[model samples]
Target chain A: MKSRNLPLNKRGFNFEMIMWIFTRLSALAMYTLLLIGFIGALLMGAREQMNFADVMRWAFMPNPSHVINTNIPDIAPWTALFWQLVASALLLVATAHGVHGLVVIADDYIVTSNGRKIVRLISMLMMASTSLIGLYILWTF
Target chain B: MGITRNVGLMTALRYKGQGPMLTFVLHRLGGMGMAVFIAIHMLSSFLGGKGGQFVNAIYEHWSFQLVIFFFVLFHAINGLRITIIDLLPKLLEYQREAIWVEWLVFIPVYGFAVFVIVSTALGSGG
Candidate 1:
């Protein structure tokens, strides 16, 4: 009897391997964002460095406090556009990949594609909403 | 769950060895460890005004050697695991033994963290 061997493919030979890569990459990206953000916070000093209020000084203003209705605190704009923006963007990318990786785990467990689809939808929605919230928070700072 | 089992078809395949499952599991546990710390980081970021008290609390309790020891171990082990899976593909063969060794090290690490947290918490007049 003869046996067949599989051929190699790039973009990873299988989904699990791909998910593995995604987790590692996402972790690394998160680590980078964290380190940068921490460094930024420490450099700014006591009251002025952190807090939604300090960052809000630069990130948001409604022209008047009473207008739009919601009591959103003004967040400060980041001191530097370069690393901070890069870090925030990287976080978004990591969040996207993280959701995708988790979806793969879900797909591995859920037998039905319909269930998988629903899960993916919910996952994406939550991720998108969080991403937006994070962005809004960053922007307000 | 069934989809995950028997699907050992690891890509970038090199060598295979029967290794202790504990080490591999511990490596994953590192992820949970980092996650706990990350949660603290986020929450602490929001704790903005209490910089001094916050720093003091951390130092007076979870910031000591035992805690740091476990934290560093988990981070190092997980980081090692990530490096192995992502970068050094050849190491998967001996991964079992490597993982077990990690667990052996983890024994002391865990002991230290537990001791630190307990002692510190107790010392805090809790």
Candidate 2:
């Protein structure tokens, strides 16, 4: 009796399965994070009476006008530190999900075993280095 | 099925087929593009933080920033759409509809970003 072969993506609670699950969950998290960042930015801009154009201009070229003029208290140092930590966490999750997603994509298109291996290796290296660099930058801030 | 799976430059341009299938391809492409941008972003942030000339040179290019923004926006929006369809299994029955809804949401949000980015860039004499 011959047995059927399972697809590489579905290996029954194996590495691929875990990575697949991580990608989905991370994507959901990323959606929330990205939304928060965008909304927060827009709100900040609005409070400063800056339109989207002004906000974007400020992004490209920071000026005194971009500074918060509201009577609201300034954010504490710890709050800034907390946000940096959040950003770092986002970086790690996004990189892992994106790298694995790309590898799986490469797997779908790349027929040869060697080609897939090469792609996965390169992706892993890139993911690791980028995450490290991003974390380093975040901590410095 | 008739679409040949050949390896070539053109292979990258060809879609596997229409609608949902195309969406899947685009999502993956967007993911890859975002991943690349994130990597570059890490390096750029590091350099820019140190006031490196390389970072300023790259940041000066509006086109690069535009592409990055577009890719990330698409990925985030489409990703949410995908999450919705996955979490609500019943929505699978309306996969086609879901995809259409995804695009409907995507276009306006993306268009707004483009308008802001382009208008600002051009207005700033970039």
Candidate 3:
């Protein structure tokens, strides 16, 4: 079998390569944040105060508004700065990761470079606006 | 680059790639499903009123939960498998075995989640 090396540019860092790395790293980051939220909820007495649904919601996004309607005794702990930051991080990372996935999937159907560029721009705008709205709610509510 | 060709649905379905191909299709679907879910969820949270609650009510249904949970669990596990294989190209030869292991892990976890969701809905008379 003849061993052939991939072109240097193909192997090197580029926009697509960077986004690929971002996708993997962002997945890890999401898992970490989810774990932190889950543990934090448990520490805050989620086992007794919340149902499975509520706990899952908090784990997915630790915003205080998510648990306010639940049986949790006090929303004070959840309304803290740390939880807000964690929720904001989750929102940004998840939105970016998902938007990139959309663009990659779109690339499968979109053949032209101009079409790809349009899809990428739309994806970026969607990611930015979604993150901003989510962050605003996370902080305000 | 080669010219892109469109295959008819029936023709596409006739081609068999077995486990790897099934996983590939499912992974893409799961990712897309979760992406849509996340978008709806964010918008609902942002809406934060009767409008938001209405959207929340839809997803809060047990059936929706079941589907969303399946997407999340499958995507996470399959993604981890892909990442591990990417990091260790030596595992490339064992990809089939890895898919088997992935199913072994996925089925039980997803089964338990479904069981819980169903029981909860029943308990609530939903």
Best candidate, DockQ: 3
Q: In order, what is each prediction's RMSD in angstroms?
A: 11.2, 6.3, 2.4
> Tens digit of lDDT per residue, candidate 1, span B22-111?
344444454444334433533444354677448535633444534544554565555556565557666667766666676677677466
TM-score of each: 0.49, 0.74, 0.90
lDDT by residue (tens digit), candidate 3, B1-126:
234788888989998989999999999999999988888887887776999889999987989989998898889889888877776677888999999999999999788878877987898799
Judged by DockQ cut-offs, the docking class of candidate 3 is medium
Where does model 1 exceed 4 Å of error? A1-20, A33-90, B1-20, B23-76, B100-126
DockQ of prediction 3:
0.49
Local accuracy of candidate 3 as per-residue lDDT tens digits, A1-141: 344488968688698898988888888888899999999999999998877766777887898877887788888999999998898888888888889999989988897888888998899799889888877777777
Candidate 2 deviant stretches above 4 angstroms: A1-11, A39-46, A49-79, B1-16, B47-52
Misplaced by over 4 Å in model 3 are A1-10, A51-53
| Leading candidate by lDDT | 3
TM-score, chain B only, every model?
0.48, 0.77, 0.94
The chain A TM-scores for the candidates, taken one by one, are 0.54, 0.64, 0.90
How do all the candidates rank in terms of TM-score, highest first? Answer: 3, 2, 1
